[model samples]
Target: MSFVKALIATWHLSILIMFHLSRMRDLKSFYLGYIKRHCQQDFPKQLSYNRFVERQTSVGVYLLLFLNLRCLGPCTGISFIDSTPLRACHIKRAHQHRSLKGWAQTGKSTLGWFYGFKLHLVINDRGEIITFRITHGATDDREPLKSEAFTNKLFGKLVADRGYISQDLFERLFIDDIHMITKRKRNMKNSLMHLHDKVLLRKRALIESVNDQLKNICQIEHTRHRSINNFCSNLLAGLIAYQALEKKPSLDLEHVVSTLKRA
Candidate 1:
């Protein structure tokens, strides 16, 4: 009986160690080496040691997503935009922490004040993330739309928030031939939305649900870093890790359509 108990304990420990190794093992040797160094020196035992580094190698994940997008044949005709907070630390330590360098800041979220950055994610109708940008808390969601990051994207219907609305942005996107859908501000006079526009506008909430799944189910916003560089590294890593799951792309549009029809 004693031997059997000891064997079971050994098996469980081995399985836990293997799971960590499997997640981190495919990471590039250089990143692995970096994590190994940190684990031996700076990393706290409480941080899950090498597992922390394995989880933050998000660049690797992006490379894969970029490739998967290439495999999708053509760009989908629809896309959605949303922003979420990526807190690096508690708000109480916002100023005291000098570690995140330029990569972190205090951002106002729907959840209230948080100390960290904002991640603007643009995903296509097919539920594939087409582009992403990490900005300081002060960066506006509309600011990135005009940049060259989206310059070549010519023909999709862009659905975003009122925060992204402006005559300049609307005209620019119009010139590029992309249709825009956004709710009007309360104070704006003569604002009217077509029935279809109202229906499409309601779908914007789907992106918010995607953000929730990323943070909650996939654990993207759980930061355990003190340095500025590692914070960025970890942020990117979580996103990439989420992307790696693209081997099984997220829900299909047909499923979403079916659920909506039933509702």
Candidate 2:
């Protein structure tokens, strides 16, 4: 069973590499060869790299699952959303000129600040990612909500931070029957958040942890792609790689069962 799992897992990684390195034939060939050497199975020799990526096949199905799978039992009708900065490198490279130069910018983060794009992720109560959108640093967190990437998500209540709260956004989501749950900003006068909302808002922290896992564990945003095409290639590859690593929803079965019981 372990061997079967490993084979299945490695195949998915191979697909991701194909996607990311597609633009750089040399890198793609080299990395695929590296995988073949490590696996001792000549995985790359089994198929044309371009054809394999185009087919998508099982890998494409899994991407769908990542965005639309239902929890094993019942959904809490809750979702969490957040965004993280993806810097190509230090700010020193800002004016050096690159393909993605106009597509990213310096943005404020909890770590002080950084220059680059932001990857927005939306996850469910069970911690399964439902949707993702990459945006310019100057793009507002709420802007992606208008994107088809997120507007089409199959969810109910969305939990986010103050950056995502706006009267227009709330109204827009409400039209889709998805309620927006976020902390009230100091400058705005609105109805007080319910005690339950406050409690659920705390769970929003899970998305941040997920961001950390993507960067530190999956190395998604740690690339130095010199061109915008390469940057997008790496970003999509990272998403694919993370999906491959995600065996089940982030929650343990015990916790999932407990949440279901409470719901």
Candidate 3:
């Protein structure tokens, strides 16, 4: 393909893949039913199944990253941070898995131990993704918050779970004008928090809802990945698909505050 033709093909194919994923279609059905049967009318030619997958996988990761960055919504100063497990394979198959051998690792979550990577996300109260990072399952949750690249543009309050509770991390973000709010561990001394902040903490479920939609609706998590490049591509595409969603879970700040005041 010529340079221009390749570029156009990539653009069209990327959109088609994302659209299919949003509708919960696995790649096989997407290629066979949509691209093979229908897409030729729009493209100069139709690629065989293997060739299409090869071309799509060969496309640069930066293209998907750029698309993801573009899909991010504006920062609302109140952000929720969390991570979810992306298991590469079932526990029974972990020993036999070679595709993600060196890259994926065993990690623990609330659900128990699993073998996979961790998807860390920072989203605003509006349920729009602010930024995200993927780390090994064993990596500390608070480690990404220390990166300037991840938190540079982030300001205001960040609410998270107890996993992110660290005095040093708190102070570091504080220095950058980002207030970190997390539930005090039971063993820690009580710290007074404003009612509004407490309410926002309860509303952190918005981010959890986003995670569910990304995995279940956008089809981010699967055990069938064959290559790290395609894995990353699928993940980035899923995130972009979620970003294109018309409606997202959000908190009504005014209503929350009013209800608290009435109490």
Candidate with top TM-score is 3
Candidate 2 vs 3: which has more lDDT:
3
> Worst lDDT window (10 residues) for model 3?
13-22
Ranking by TM-score: 3, 2, 1
Which sections of candidate 1 miss by over 4 Å?
1-74, 244-263
Q: CA RMSD for every model?
A: 10.5, 7.7, 1.8
Tens digit per residue, CA lDDT, model 3, 126-205: 89889899999899999999899999878998999999999988998999999999999999999789887898888888
Query: What is the Cα-based lDDT of residue 42 in candidate 2?
Result: 46
Model 2 agreement with the true structure over 13-117: per-residue lDDT tens digits? 465655443333344464467554564464634445555443334454444343345321233567788889998667766777475677778887667667888
Taking the tens digit of each residue's C-alpha lDDT, what string does model 1 give over 73-136? 2347677778888887789988776667566777787688888788887777655566777788
Candidate 3 C-alpha error for residue 120, in Å: 0.4
lDDT, each prediction: 0.61, 0.65, 0.82
What is the C-alpha local distance difference test score of candidate 2? 0.65
Candidate 2 backbone collisions, by pair: none
lDDT of 3 at 51: 70
